[model samples]
Target: MAAPTFTDAVVKAMKTLYPPELADSAWDNTGLLLDQALLPEGTESKQSEGAVLLTNDLTAAVVDEALEKQVNIIVSYHPVIFRALKSLSNQDPMQKHLLRLIAARVAVYCPHTAVDAARGGLNDWLCDIILSETKEAERKVVQPISRPLPESLQGLGYGRTMKLQGPMPLTTILKNLSRGLGDQQHIVLKDADAELIVTGEMDHHSALRYTQLGQTVVTVFHSNSERQYLTQVLKPELEQMLSQSSRAEGRVLVSQADRDPFETIDISSLGS
Candidate 1:
């Protein structure tokens, strides 16, 4: 089928799949991995097709990868260029990245906190994964990760709680968490070998302790952690555009670009 134009694909995806309610009130901008003008009218070049790049930071290596792949658009979760830019002197790393982006004619877009805070965003995405695995477990799913109440206080730090049921292998659970969160942060899943503990956010001491107990638990940044939204919400929207475009024209070949920027983590020796 003829793919939809990139603009149509991006616009439709953002408007239909990511409703405003899904985004946080504070997040002002959300949609398009990058501006449309950067690429061919509605069509990304062949060099910049397939594999959408996802990342909070748009680093040199990341941009280089896009160039090598001939990707014209970057569907970044975090905006590489936030606020206003007075100059593009390439003085800063970000600026350097931007310079490269413009030179390569790569399109970059960020969904930011809107995607994070969305109803099916990071938090809920994590919760759903955990709950799905423990669907048949003895314990009940709580809903979200809750921080443990202070030793003496009545509530946990963030009031977040774990919703995992049954005795999941520490390794298994942590793997799921890391995968669901896109392995952005290093967390030590504590003596969670045979125990379960929930917290509002990850603490260094707690994370360290988890490692000491032969477990790994670490809380990743809100940005790096939840990336599946692209596939769950963004990609589908892109596909739909292609479907519509095919019906309208001979074929609208629309594709995405890869732009994530975190290096792979060797979880086996995460802290060492």
Candidate 2:
């Protein structure tokens, strides 16, 4: 498939898989934020043959990777264009990334909170990670879709909560979380009404408040909580679904340049 046709297929697949309507439009910017057709035209040599790059964030490194590989489109999990841009200049690092992609004709799409609210989406994946130790668990939405509710997505919503059939030790849960997110550090167990909360991050004060009320919030930093889903879940799905939808071979590649900016340092050893 040609690059344009391939990008169209990706946009379609993204919409079919994680509908933009499911996103929290109140704050999020979802869907195809950067369209090549709308942006300034540039030389787009067919390099990777309809390859789609997946990343948790659209950082400068991710943009460089996309351009180097000449990916047809980028399915960034978090939207790059979150706020209004008064100007597209080299003054801002983000605007520079956009400018480079525009020059290379690499399009960008973000699924954001849409993936969180969709059935079998990011939040659901998080639920699976939270319940990795449980043999079976009942899960439900913390907030259900209220507006423009489609019949197919009747029960799908933003956050998810799990109720286990049997009580599992919090230590056991943390162990599974380590295995799931590929990070063994920051596994702290306080308490929770739901017994556990596996989230990206929480405000310091809000987390304190929750803990005061006996709710444990497990934060694996922001992007760390979301990065694995691209490689483990979305990559294979995109390859299969995009191929079928386009009736042509389409590839989905997870960006190697993306990662959580935070790291856990052992100060005890550092000072020694």
Please write out the lDDT profile of model 1 over residues 71-111, one tens digit for every residue.
54666665665456787786788778777777666667666
In candidate 1, position 61 carries an lDDT of 65
Model number with the top TM-score: 2
- With candidate 2 superimposed using the best TM-score fit, by how many Å does residue 167's alpha carbon deviate from the native? 1.6
Clashes of 2: 1
The TM-score measured for candidate 1 stands at: 0.57
lDDT at residue 240 of model 2 (Cα atoms): 72
Local accuracy of candidate 2 as per-residue lDDT tens digits, 126-215 = 767766655532333232222332233233235676655556677777777888877657764556665565666666666676688786
Residue 32, model 2: lDDT of 94
Looking at model 2, residue 159 earns an lDDT score of 63
- In order, the Cα lDDT scores of the candidates are 0.52, 0.75
